[model samples]
Target: MRGEAGLPPVDMSVKVGPLALPSPVLVGSGTFGFGEEYAPYCDLARLGAIVTKAVTLRPREGNPGPRIWETAAGMLNAIGLQNPGLERFLAEKLPPLVAAGHVVIVNIAGHDVEEYVKLAGALDAAKGVAAIEVNVSCPNVSRGGIEFGRDPAVLGELVRAVRGATRLPLIVKLSPNVSDIVPLAAAAMEAGADALSLINTLLGMAIDARQRRPRLANVTGGLSGPAIKPVALRMVWQVWQALRPPIIGMGGIMTGEDAAEFMLAGAAAVAVGTANFVDPTSASRVAAELEDFCRGQRINHVSELTGGLQV
Candidate 1:
């Protein structure tokens, strides 16, 4: 029951490039802002790592009026990557959490490739940023998002540009909006991504039948939570087969069993995003259950379960 340093041994310790972790139950970026908003409920140290909200090149007011509209299984978000920008996030937001003792993964976005490089270089030298996750899937953004992600060449170029800018490990957050995931993942890995996180969200909408109008201000919002699970799992398996990089499987994970399914599908690690919106302590609880299941299955290490499935 005891591990190194006499700590309680767990089965979910995973890896991201050179950084090995104590668990694979991290909360997703964008949903969790700067790693402090949900602190009242869960211990930050219990997660494999914390991916902060998406910070942009400049502060954005985001979309007008209503940004989130509840759907049957998941919520549609048109938050538009509203953030404090890199300067504010590093100076004001990340410092305090850096001292709080957790691996910090900063999710970042920009309007252009140059902006991405600039932000990447700044975060690479940042005191607390353990890694940078490129948010290529934010649909509401004007540039450096879907335009780049929709095409393999553009996505590769954007990732390579950011990779050249920073010494820190890069985790490219891939979009499910693309047609073929194989070409996309292959492009990212070839362009110098240390790891990849799938997926951002599937494009969806909501309609108020009584009013005969669209619900979200943007009309269309990225669909996250449980609704996108099946597609996300398929992409994870495809990308794992194509490139074989460290894959962070996410999208619609709500239970410990769901997290286990991601690992079985070839995810090196799993992230809980929209599920956090549903259950405040979902990440920690999932971690505990994952460990317990590992013990029951007689699996000594969680890493042994990665890609356990053939198809």
Candidate 2:
């Protein structure tokens, strides 16, 4: 299809394992809520997919007051995976997005391996779930609260179990707090992950100088935004070089150029996270901007940007 001004349309469709997306710009989980929340701001159909917020087996109230703190170029959050639980998600949340004909990739977190398996199994049976993004950033209750993604062995086991439970395309969301991310990425892929989500939030903290207290009630929270873009890009490059698996890159992506940077670093697709809070229409805007970038570079396919970086 051609766009306005007699410009040829850039083919934006991308594949994340078995799931195919209309665009490479997806709204990251937790930031976009469910797809309907942003209906008034942008066209949902323009997005690659809507990754729903992390859903648990039961309802959660999330973190206490002071859950958010703005930093120099990013923000910290300890929302604690607040959600209305699995049953409600299937019965209520999933239906609307599917009914609207939006591609839905559900982000799920569990305290244990069994919980992960159960959640995956349930989603496998549900209609309209294009994929499952395993949020291994959540603490593993069975392992002294150490994040599942922090330990390669544990993450592998978890992914293996989830893989067995569902036939859906599986994407593991890796944590950036690790000493090296390549091992974790390898583990996920070896365990049957179709794709990897590079760099979840980095661990960070803030303090109230005068009061001598921590800024967030949780004492530490996940840091995200422009400040982490370089780190995220580096990680994506390292993992892409090491494993070459499809990566859904995210972290401080505020513009199309930012998304392009990730693509060059080896991300098959990009997700808009912290930027969503800044502009509800950020994902769609990024998609348009990426197409514009392709046109300027005389690139016919958006996929051509992936791993196009020059040493």
- Which candidate has the highest lDDT of all? 2
Error of 1 at 72 (Å): 1.8
lDDT tens digits, residues 145-249, model 2?
A: 237888899889999999999999999998898899999999999999999998788889999999999999888888999999999999999999988899999
Candidates in order have lDDT scores of 0.85, 0.89
Error of 2 at 203 (Å): 0.3
Candidate number of the best TM-score: 2
Model 1: residue 109 alpha-carbon error in angstroms? 0.4
- Lowest lDDT sum, 10 consecutive residues, model 1, at 1-10
What lDDT, from 0 to 1, does candidate 1 have?
A: 0.85
Q: Which ranges in model 1 have alpha carbons more than 4 Å from their true place?
A: 1-8
TM-score result, candidate 1: 0.95
